[model samples]
Target chain A: MSTSTEKEMWVTKLRKGWQKNLPVEKLLPDTQPAYVASWIYLFGVATLASLGLIIATGLWLSFEGASWYHGSNVGHFVNSLHFWSVQFFFVFMVVHLWGKFWMAAWRGRRMLTWITGALAFVGSIATAFTGYLVQSNFDSQWISYEAKDGFNSVGIGSRFTVTNFGQMLLLHVAFLPVIIGIITLIHVLLVRAKGVVPPIDAFNKELGERK
Target chain B: MGIFDHFMNLRAVYIHLGWFQISITNLIVVLGMLVLFGLALFLPFPGNKKKGQK
Candidate 1:
């Protein structure tokens, strides 16, 4: 009987703490309306969607064994999907980056968002490089040979071998994904924390009126 | 040995239809580009936001 009472008391305390922590009303207070300017904001969404497709197709390719992909018709189609996904991914990502740059979207209290995004971009490029190396084709061979000299000159060559299939595949498929994923998560959190940056003209107007 | 034989066969076929294979690859790439262009038309691109709404 005593143990049952103790358990009930503990459960009550835990429930109270969880309720206090959630305080959804406090978190979702009314703020400035979200600016959904035309369809341009969709570029970020499109890039994310392309990344989703890439991950799905990449999983499929991995399951089939990388070697099986080059010879079989289905494998070739999957390879095409992966290639096209990368191409679209880069195109949308570039547009998203340029869009953020021109808007000076780093303004307000969201500098962390901007910085995290920049880091993610760097991570994505590294991931792409590893991907190129893992292709195991003439392109991969050529890029590996050419890139080795450049990497060697920078002293990072000792850490990452462009010619090593095992290392490159692991980096491309596992390690870089984790890094980029973490950066993306942090970036989204910062964006939600600060909300969207206001329009530049509004900023200019506020400054002008103050003057 | 199994994978090597498959690749050798693929190479043999590709060698015989060299130009055709290349053209098909180019066509696929072009189709991919076209798909991207179509998406660009529908998707938000970031610069079209209104100027003064903060």
Candidate 2:
């Protein structure tokens, strides 16, 4: 029953609310706290860089088709890049997770940030699993046969059949990537919004060492 | 024509201990990450000294 003018006002209100919550300065800060100068902060960026390479190589593979990579020399090279990128991605991501956990990065009411980052990690793992299934090789066939029992035991095999090459490929290249990308975006946004957590000593001193 | 030709075609080396076994490549990569993480934790990062000076 709302009028057109009232509906338009709601859009304006939404826009203003969004900007208020995430202003440009906070979203893209030029300067960070001096504690961020530590080498520990590099792992997060390293993880991000590996993810970028992964997406680039994955996109190229998708363009050429999954089966094409099996026989072509250039395709093999690109496929190798894709595989190595996953290795690097997992290495950096696990290190980043360790760094954040040691620092208790969820402090200062940043639980959502921690949750989103963890979700991104889990989603990335599933995406990588599907990538293995779609490799279109004897290894993939062996993996699929091995994994099918586990999926079937969980009663999700019919919906997400590991034996279905088409389903696994689409999940690897399209579905899970989108989910992981969204979760990663939210994680980054939350980090920017909340600012990096302070060092333990600094935080303890600020709180009068109550704990 | 790829730069990693030699690296890619190397023989797969494995270490076996009783029933446990792991490829040398995986062992090296894991060990390398551990070393890198250790270095990152202890190494002095540049630019922190001048952080608040100006």
Candidate 3:
């Protein structure tokens, strides 16, 4: 018999919370609404795929070390792949954002989803900036030289230290990625929980009639 | 790999319009993205038919 003062275990409470907020069916639905058949929806998945590739290539580069990537031909190829993956990620993410904006994806109490996505974009920019700062190339040195003044003007240069390769490397490889990952995860979970926003035409008869 | 080297070594071509300027590579990439976005809007997605139809 449990005492009246007995407190629930934190693990049990956390499990219950997850179950309440995100059930298995909601988290992994087999079917989507008919309106999900648009090609614009594909860009979000493309962005995810590119992000996966970027992480994979980045991991490979990290394992290979700076000397390998800087000196070896295979390392250069891997580095190139990482770079291209980033390019694709940005393109796909931007296209997805634009498509969602045009469709008014924030409708139906999904403002938090939109906010998370916007935050993820901002976080990605920081991540990319740090990445450029850590490249150890002439371009990276030039970029850092130009960027230091901007950071100093904002009174963050003393702390952020754009000129410090080690600090920038840690931020790029570790900190910013984690922040972006958290934001992206939240955005995706919100999408799953709230369901994709229906087309604007679903509400407006005149818009529906135009199609 | 040699082909990649050749491509990488190729000089970037730039377009100039008054004060505006951009590399051909950047221009192609941007134009390609726009075309893809347009096509995505217009293309007929498979299985998008009415529920009663095949």
Winning model by DockQ:
3
Once fitted onto the true fold, the runs of candidate 1 whose alpha carbons sit more than 4 angstroms away are: A1-34, A203-211, B1-54
> In candidate 1 chain A, where is summed lDDT lowest over 10 consecutive residues?
A24-33
Tens-digit lDDT string for candidate 1 (A74-97): 887788788779888877777777
Ranking of all candidate structures by their lDDT, best first: 2, 3, 1
DockQ in order = 0.10, 0.51, 0.54
Give a tens-digit lDDT track for model 3, residues A74-139: 888898898889988988898899899999999999999999999988889899888888778887
Candidate 2 per-residue C-alpha lDDT over A26-118 given as tens digits, one digit per residue, 9 for 90 to 100: 999888887787787999989999999999999999899888887899998899899899999999988889889999999889999999999
Candidate 2 regions off by >4 Å?
A1-10, B1-11, B49-54
**Candidate 1 CAPRI category:** incorrect
Error of 3 at B44 (Å): 0.8
- Share of real interface contacts recovered by each model? 0.14, 0.45, 0.48
Across residues B1-54, which tens digit of lDDT does each residue of candidate 3 receive? 335778866887889999999999888778878887888889988876555422
Q: After superposition, how far is residue B25 of candidate 2 from its true place, in Å?
A: 1.7
User: Higher-lDDT candidate among 1 and 2?
Assistant: 2
Interface RMSD of each: 7.7, 2.1, 2.0
